[model samples]
Target: MTIESVLSNNRIIAATQLKDIKRADESQCCAMILMNGKLSELMHMPMVHKPLFIHMDLLKGLKNDKEGIAFLKEFINPTGIVTTKGNLIEAAKKEGLLTIQRIFLIDTNSLKTAIQNIKDYRPDAIEVMPGIAPKIVKALKQELDIPIILAGLITTKEDVLHAFEAGAEAVSLSNQLLWNGTTEAITTK
Candidate 1:
């Protein structure tokens, strides 16, 4: 399914990097970015009844290759995957797994490279890091047709709103308080 279909009404994803597993399991967000814990542990965790996107960078025992992508799809059984590697994203897509390519806008050069690479990889979605940059978000949105998920350093309601205004399809945040707060706001609206 498309990332837009997965996102649905929820414009915020619960990023479980530093989050307690119990809290993440009870999160109100419709999707969870699993950044910690082993694949075995994650499958057993009482997570919220939502789609889970495994973070490939944090996952162990998986090679970043076609065979590895097949293994992840068959064994891990995640709804999607998050990764910065262009090759992995491409391979994952071929494996019928939704791919969210993480792009860190460290500089103009990095942004340029990401744009070029994304054109080649064409993941299901693009997650721009340091989500605080509305201008960059706007620029990327203008250039790319894929869904955009703003992640990292998103700590407040204003930050989330700003990202949306700047053309981010959604925002991924690790703060549980912000997750609940955003859920309330999204539902109320």
Candidate 2:
């Protein structure tokens, strides 16, 4: 299924920055971005009903190559994956997993590079860093066909609303309160 279909109702995805299993379990978000969890920890953690998108960078014991992708698919069995690497995104797609390519928009050059990469890799969706850049989000939304997930530095209801207004399909934030506090606003959108 499409990322948009999965995230259509849930606008705030829990971004688990640390290995806080308790916090993740307590979160109201229906989707999660596992930013910092070891392979063992992830494997052992109790599964929640929502979709889990593992961050390849923070996850240990995997090579981020074809073999690692295989391991993730066979063993970890995540609903999807998040990575900045185009190759990994391609590999994950081959393995029948949804992919979210994380792009850090530091400047114009980076944005250009990310756009080119998107054309090449064709991930199911993309997560843009520093979600405050409404202009950049609007630009990317205008250019890209896939859904955009605005992430990072999003701690308030206004930030969430602004991202949605700028054309982000959803927003990922580490703050749990925002997940609860912003649901009404997102649902009404």
Clashes of each: 0, 0
1-189, model 1: which lDDT tens digit per residue?
Answer: 789888786778889852465576576676889886665565455644678788888876566777878888887677889999988898888888899999899899999999999999899999999898878977887788999999999998888878877878889988788766554484344
- Quote model 2's TM-score: 0.92
What digit string (tens of lDDT, one per residue) describes model 2 on residues 1-189? 668777866678888754564576576675888887677776677766678888997788678897898898998788899999999999999999999999999989999999999989999999999888866977887788898999989887888888887878889888777766445755464
The best candidate in terms of TM-score: 2
Cα misplacement distance, residue 82 of candidate 1 (Å) = 0.3
- Candidate 2 residue spans exceeding 4 A from truth: 17-19, 22-26, 186-189
The local lDDT score (0 to 100) that residue 95 gets in candidate 2 is: 94
